[model samples]
Target: MENRVEFYRMSKTSNPKILNRITEQILKAGFSGNIKVYDLGLDDEASMSLIVEGTYENEDCCVAVGYGMNRQNLAIRKKWFRHAP
Candidate 1:
């Protein structure tokens, strides 16, 4: 995939659910990869996302947690990619 981060969100669900949903998507799609979770903690006020990524059927797919910031809807997109392996 290209060297850019696309926009995607998973239905505005609770934190861990985001990861769970993403995992299912990737797995069902026949993609194998790791989940890169960024947790700065709520105490730090650092907004981070739990990311699930992999290459599915030769296409790059990624899912991230989002509470809104980029104006995109809270849902998943097959176009999203993070250059993940």
Candidate 2:
């Protein structure tokens, strides 16, 4: 098959909820690749932009997380990359 990339998100939900949702979707899609997670601040617009660029530029897909943020709570963003072996 021709090479392809995909993106996914399961935010605003509990860990279990997100895990279950993502797992089901990933399994159904039969995806195999590397998953990367990045933690961006709540209002860190500049960093967020850089993160997006870093994740998407020259890559197949990327995911950005933006929500509540603080020293204690941190939002998680993930990106999945698929390449030929």
Candidate 3:
């Protein structure tokens, strides 16, 4: 099966601590492969949006990550979407 890519929008704080925390959370939730967390510029609310891409064992894992991030105040832009590249 192909790897799944998920997207999320977080507060405009892209500090190393935040990035590391996100990466750690994803990995702890059973995500595999390299995880990339970068700012995708600003959103409509003027808050900095972040794009988190990684491979997971299943969609449920992604959902769990999203919820976890949400609890941390990261708004999930979309869940379980395909990334064309």
Candidate 4:
């Protein structure tokens, strides 16, 4: 996920809420549309909603790092992902 790494290098925003250790702020938001996980690099093109400030965090405040596509769209690709960080 080279693009995901690049986002961390270039982003400047911050979150006030203490999120989980594993977190990913949206440099670009995603929406309900036909797309792929890698399309997250497209700041203005992805099908997700506009996120002024977003922190994708999990339970216990651990920041979740990953990509998201619409629920209905996942079946189109049937891709399985694993995260180890």
The CA lDDT of each predicted structure is 0.41, 0.36, 0.49, 0.24
Candidate 2 TM-score over all chains jointly:
0.27
* Model 3 lDDT per residue over 1-85, tens place: 4333333454565466656666655566555655555555554443445555565555432232232334444445555654454
Cα displacement (Å) at residue 74, model 2: 24
Cα-lDDT of candidate 3? 0.49
- What stretches of model 1 exceed 4 Å from their correct place? 1-14, 35-53, 58-85
Candidate 1, 1-85: lDDT as tens digits: 2322222443344456544544454355455544343322322232234454545456656554432334322333324756534
What ordering of candidates by TM-score runs from best to worst? 3, 1, 2, 4
TM-score of each candidate?
A: 0.30, 0.27, 0.43, 0.16
lDDT of 2 by residue, 46-75 (tens): 222112212243455544443332322223
Per-residue lDDT of candidate 4, residues 3-39 (tens digit): 2321232122223231111123332322212212222
| Global local distance difference test of model 2 | 0.36
Distance from true location, Cα of 75 in model 2, Å: 22
